[model samples]
Target chain A: MTSAPELVAIVPAGGAGTRLWPLSRRSRPKFLLDLLGTGRTLLQDTADRLAPLTGPDGLLVVTGTAHAAAVADQLPQLAGDGAANLLTEPSPRDSMAAIGLAAAVVEHRHGPTVVGSFAADHVVPEPGGFHDAVRTAVEAARAGYVTTIGIAATGPSTAFGYVRRGAPLEGVPGAYAVASFVEKPDEDTARGYLATGEYSWNAGMFVARTDVLLGHLTRHQPTLEAGLREIAAAWDTPAREEVLARVWPGLTKIAIDHAIAEPVAAEGGVAVVPGAFSWDDVGDWDALGGLLPADEAGAHTLAAATSAGDNGAARPTTAGPLLAIDSPDAVIASDGGAVAVLGLPGVVVVRTGDAVLVVHRDHAQRVKAVVDALAAGGRPDLL
Target chain B: MTSAPELVAIVPAGGAGTRLWPLSRRSRPKFLLDLLGTGRTLLQDTADRLAPLTGPDGLLVVTGTAHAAAVADQLPQLAGDGAANLLTEPSPRDSMAAIGLAAAVVEHRHGPTVVGSFAADHVVPEPGGFHDAVRTAVEAARAGYVTTIGIAATGPSTAFGYVRRGAPLEGVPGAYAVASFVEKPDEDTARGYLATGEYSWNAGMFVARTDVLLGHLTRHQPTLEAGLREIAAAWDTPAREEVLARVWPGLTKIAIDHAIAEPVAAEGGVAVVPGAFSWDDVGDWDALGGLLPADEAGAHTLAAATSAGDNGAARPTTAGPLLAIDSPDAVIASDGGAVAVLGLPGVVVVRTGDAVLVVHRDHAQRVKAVVDALAAGGRPDLL
Candidate 1:
């Protein structure tokens, strides 16, 4: 096994995650929430997963200015590294700028080391498979390809984009040259892609040498690249805030896929490393419900299993007891008080201190519309 | 339009209303709650409806000992009669004892006066129609018959029992002899009942001269009648508590319908006055939802309408603002913070400070099972 000591995991912790609203709010986003009832927040779990590969003090978290303090509080170990690993963006400028800035900063500090960007709100149940995929991707990255770990498409899921694998890499056994990156497909198309057995779900994870990622960005999104470089130059200095305030907002707002992966793949410079781990974005209550094991009543409670610590001791969150009667496949999440769901099959009930959200599983995606309505209704306090 | 000066209103306020769990509890039942978003509670509404017929001192409220204070607080005008009109039962001995004791007490206080017993938790929207029906019932009652107000059956609802009307009475113009009283029927039977215009919903509103109601009770339930008579003898005296404490528990636990109405109808001694007013028992959340007006989004907010006073001025309750997004036909009740329901049509969400209940409209009747489960689960605090 090759230990890539120079590799750093760059975690871009963003997204309002309105679909998980009342649980994932504006102030407490999904990344900061322990959604799985696994005692650790998604960000902490992401850090734990990458810890084996990156080693201690080798993880970088890029988050919004509003969430920087919360990110720091959830991850106290970053304090030992002078908290330099925690990067706070002045404001959201989309994925390209966020990841590019982190890449440029890592390159400046470590001199061309490999950096892997992972979302802080996803779940990978079996870290062994993830670590293996990351190792293969890192090797491909060292060989100069902007590599991504493609999650093995378990079903005909229309929620995620797909990456088509071309020919296998010559020296890298588990890595393959990427043919193309496709947008989220309809069910029929997703089924067709799954039938080919060569397409994998793009989980937005990218492993690449910092210079290579920045070079791809420079080639395609020059303005964003230049802005990220300027911010990186002042990142470790007293001029950090000043430079960020001047250049960050002007940076092009685009995802890393549009700016780098898709363009780089067109030039035959990207690779795909198949990941066999159980993975999910937990995009909505329905998705989250699928991840939780149901009790005897077939009700999924996002509390009981979540109250345990890493050592299996009780570490209860604010959620009270949940009672479900004759409600099969009900998903209940509460941080306020006891929730009782009766006779509603596949219903989703979420209770926070100030807000309560009730939705049916089929309508989980429409929760964003609720957040939008709240915004339009001038309830920013809720949003 | 002869005014029945000798008439008195006897309200028997009981029933835990378990189907409306988390809203109606053992201590605070449906009668005490402003369920319709009307400023007046069901009990208060009943009192208000009967006040014009029964003079200020003619309304007698019979309730369990636990709720006597709340009843007194809700209907303070009843205190003017030295609290003599408010009858507190030592414990629940079913509706028969509850109404029987009040009937005997009224007979004791005002000999042979007409007394109408109405449930404290029912709604009659058009009081003019109710007044006409009560007048007809009082005429039938003055003829020495046990008269009941049979609500005009709006639909083939299986939630309530049916009173089959026989031929019109000899002298009472709008009153007819009650052929029989049927139990809550199956859907097919209810549809058949609705087809026959002779059948009306038995709303359990009984009007009779106090002595006449007692005569029927004495013949049908002699022991219960004897116990209530014994209790009534000492009711307004110093020995009232002693007699109640000794005789209350020994009274037979039987509903007035089984003990009096059904048997009396079998003997051709019962009469029914067809009530044209809109009436509902508010038996479950679905029934309650029907009584509430929908907002612009087609969601029925039970709290918003309930907070207003009798004059239609906003008397806001403690409930925070409710937000419903795309959830048409949703009924939301909360005494807690804000409640948001999204994409769940015909859903019912109720929240109190200690508990939350989420159920579908079709499943609203099954809420009693939730309360039962809570009690079985040792969550009496929630019950």
Candidate 2:
């Protein structure tokens, strides 16, 4: 068979991740942090995972202007030739503008090639399965369908949306038409969806030909599509700044799922490839703790520049060691100094230079409420 | 009737307070910390309460040499007259040496004054009742009894010892003969003691004339009494350090209760003054939380140099405010930066410059185990 069409990976690197605060802040968000004590940050790991599928030079990163420098610093391999693959938005316009702009730029510069969008802050262990799924999704995308990689449901998790799958596509193996996309469900509904054995967790991974994605956007959201196209036309020229300054602000601020996937799926256009890789958004401290290996006491500690050995014991490479007593299931992180948790099980304690956060694992999601309260109290320095 | 025999307060300010770890360290113990957020440390508050009863020059503080400078810095008013009243020990020799040495020195300087030994870390709110109790104890001491102030039992607490009271003393009103002094008992014994109406919480507050106290020591442990007297002879001379180096190390390493109070009470030479005041040893974070009035959310925040008003709302005078959400009855203290607690009811969070401690109120006493573990792990910087 002839070589498959080249695919470019577009990463939308954003989100403050307030639910993981004290470790994740506005100035230093989750994507740029070595949150799991791995030597590489989440963004670097994402790039590492996608580089094999997209080739060495075929990756584009779209991020907010504030984080563009950090994103480039984190992924030096993507920073070649004036770092042309690094795209910066003046302000956040959600996933639609971020991904659409990258697709339009790829189409303008390299013709209509297949492209996949991945978040910069998700964790995927065991990348072989991910590679297989993305390859199948790219194959389906080349067949003129907007394809998405739906993660295998590890549990009946109410934290993630579900994607219902239809019959397998005629040509693409391991790929099926999308029946529907459901929002985050209640526990019972999620259990029902899991029991049906026809649904996968929506991990927000989408792949399509650049022309196919842009054409769908042009039909569904003409103003946003036109703005991205106009910016792309002048991207390589001196007129890029002028076009972006004028068109970027008025672009519709909508998510890609709403702008394209749902509407397109209703018309029998979307396809999904089942991804059998372990994945998590690391949405909160509890979620991050789930990805880490527990110590002998069944506690998890996340430190910078450390890793767990094959036997699941931490080999800490830095100071500020976590000392816990009678505190099982504790998730303790400190960039400041030693943190000692005594008799508080399932507790989350995080300490940075300027702030400290203590919460129960069950209340990890409510940490965003703390961020909101800080914002309301005019303590943006902490946020 | 005899002007209360000129009472002198002796504060044996020792104990590393490992249960209050991270805030109370070996070098900087709990007595020197402003744990109640009253703009004064427990040592200073103790001095403030006793200075009124003992007069400006009548209160003597005995602490370790490592904390002498910090103690002097906290209570500058006690540093007058060549700083003679601020006694510094060469090393810890337990309560007998600490209190007996101070009593001997008082007798050497002031000649047979009634000396009351109060812990420098205890908290006595509504000191009117405490003052009245001390006055009555002083009268009993003048009547040749080793008198102790017994706190009204608030609950069946197994954390403190119980003092059983006997028939009222013949002449000293509100002072009763001590039936016995019992060690910290099991839960059932403590509950039985509380139900008898004849037992009071042993607060470790003992008062007696310096001559009477030294006489009891001489009868019980003559070698300890002689060593203390030898040190007292050179206290005001250049020979003080020389004598301390020669004798202090060999002094009996015993508690005053075992050496004097228990035996003297068995002989009916000990008296009990019922103290109907709100008193706490401030033994752990839980005890401190009980003393401080809670805010509207039923949480307590203690900061350096800040005070809670009569209504119990904190009037913080600096930055780094303590913020909490859905955390009730939480005790948070910070000398570092802002601390936020979410959804952890009855949690105690303490942050110092080099260490942070998180524990539940129910397990506050177990913090000493954390300190022991840290010490075992060669983390002396944390201790």
Candidate 3:
């Protein structure tokens, strides 16, 4: 078999947010949590999946300073000399800054290689399909097209934005030109997109040569691109911290979707590689409950991390036994005590040391309102 | 106002069964708990409501050995010389033994005084109506009847047993001979009972002369009565522990309703004083949620006990904040963390030191299934 192309996987380890309150807090973001009750955390799982594609030294993680140490701890590959690739942002400047800085730094070290940006917190169950999608995207990247892996639409989900496919890329196999990028649509609009069979979910998995991404940024957002380049130049030098402090704070805070993806697609410079793989952002408790495995009783439990020395244990925040009764599809996690759910199907009960959250699956998104109430009620410590 | 007679309130501090698990454990029975957000525990509240009628040093308490210390701690009246009136059972022998033992002891100390057995765990928000019922019951008791306060049926609550009223008692006003005492009925039967105005809920508040209660016990359950009397004879003496060790375990584990109320009603020896006051057994979370006062948002929050030094606060078992959102009439409680309820109206989320319970009020009585599940799953410790 032929070897995979030279590509760096940039994982922006942020945004497991308020929608996953109590479990995913400001102190413990979603990427750092073992939300899937699997052997590894979301960040670790992302690293493991991308490791084969990027090779040992090609994986670079960019996370907030608050989560930097935790990222390093979870990823032993980042120990010693490998620590150089683990980038820590001084403060949050949105996704554009996080992904852009990592891309710029990779270019500074390895000169214009293919790098794909993947969120550290997203869930991609089977690595086989993901690897295939990434390889195709990387080939399109080598052909000088900014390629994004458009996840095959499982359903007309109104939660995610849709990317419409146009003509097949002339040079690259399994790659198509993007017609347009649309924001989250209403049910009717999303259903229409599905019927056309030309639409896929924009999962934000963009693969491109460092030069092409920076060149697009230069044309779209020149000032933001320059600051990222400055930060990357001094990233490995003794002036790293000082450069970040001065340049990072002033970087224009915008999502890469706004600064690059939408604009590049408009110019016919962006390509879509349809990813026929299960991918989820795990946006809210409802989405998360759907991702978790159900027991014989049909109860879905979010157990503790494998780091605790037990594969499927209690919550990482607290340790105890979990039990669900008459509560089918119950998403139960407790901070430090036993949890038992009863007589409620599709119940989501997450109890942390600081707070307990109870919501039904249908009302999962409404958990944001609860977090807002707590903040407005002057209990931000709970958030 | 006519002075309340020489009546002694025998508070049977027992029976908050598995339905109220976690909050009411074997070590901490329901009677010892402040299920209400009110500062005083059910036991303390029972004593407070009865103190005026019982007079100084006239109130007596009978509780299981495990909860004796907690009972004494909550009721300061049980301290010093008053400790004599606080009776402890070496082991639980059900309601009949508990009430009988207290009556025998009360008669031994105070010469067959009119004694009323009020459960420590029941809720009586208004003392006026409760006291009026007891006074009328006391008159019936003095006239040689085993009188139980019949609560005016608020609804067709199939959870409670019903007492059918007969002809009015000859000498006692507002008191009638019990036509029959029925067990918990089906919804159809309960509705039928409610249609007849003569039917009232059997609140289990039995008021009677100690001799009358003992006489019924002697006629029906002689062996159990004799054992209780023997235990009572040695109760306040040095041989108290020795006699309890011998007789307590052998006594019949039967409810007072079966031993006396049911049989005595057959012989026309049972009287029921109509008590038109709100009384709740606090049978399950549904009943509890109903008994608790609602806030402006219509959420009935069961806060920490007043003993916590904060009037309306978190769960008594925990120390933290509580928040309820779009979930109207949500009953949220936590053992030791802040609790938030979202979008589930009439939801009951109870997190305890050992386990968490989530159910809707519509399925509140079904919480017993959760407890049973825990027990079957080898988590009896949670129960």
In model 3 chain B, the worst 10-residue window by lDDT is: B306-315
In the range B114-208, model 2's lDDT, one tens digit per residue, is 99999989888878899999999999999999999999988888888889999999999999999999999999999999888999988889999
TM-score (chain A only) of candidate 2? 0.94
> What TM-score is obtained for chain B in each of the predicted models?
0.94, 0.93, 0.92
User: All models: lDDT?
Assistant: 0.86, 0.86, 0.82
Candidate 1 residues A60-153, lDDT tens each? 9999988888788778777664888899988888888888998898887767889999999999888999999999999999999999999988
Local lDDT at B329 for model 3: 87
Q: How well does candidate 1 match the true structure in TM-score terms?
A: 0.93
Predicted candidate 2 versus true structure: per-residue lDDT over A327-360, tens digit per residue: 8999988875889998888999998777789999
- Which 10 consecutive positions of candidate 2 chain A have the poorest summed lDDT? A306-315
Per-model TM-score on C-alpha atoms: 0.93, 0.94, 0.93
- Once superposed on the true structure, which residue ranges of model 1 sit more than 4 Å away at CA? A1-4, A304-315, A318-321, B1-5, B191-196, B304-315, B318-326
Given candidate 3, what's the lDDT at residue A105? 87
Give one digit per residue, the lDDT tens place, for model 3 in A1-383: 12323998999888748888878887888887888876588888888899999888778888877888788878867654748878888888999999999999888887887899998889988889999999999999999999999988888899899999999999788999999999999999999999999999998889999999999999999999999999999988899989988889999999999999999999999999998889889899989988888887788786554232333222345456677777788888765677777778888988665667888889888788887887887877777
The parts of candidate 2 lying over 4 Å away from their true place are: A1-5, A305-317, B1-5, B305-319
Candidates 2 and 3 compared by lDDT, better number: 2
lDDT per residue (tens digit) for residues B1-383 in model 1: 12335678989888889988788889888888888776778888988899888877779999888888888878888786479789998888888898899888877766778998898999888899999999999999999889999988888888889999999999999999999999999989999998889999988899998888899988999999999999998998999989988899899999999999999889999999998889889999999999889999999987632223443233457666687877899999987578999878888999877678898989898998888888887777777
Between 1 and 2, whose TM-score is larger? 2
| Residue B150, candidate 1: alpha-carbon lDDT | 92
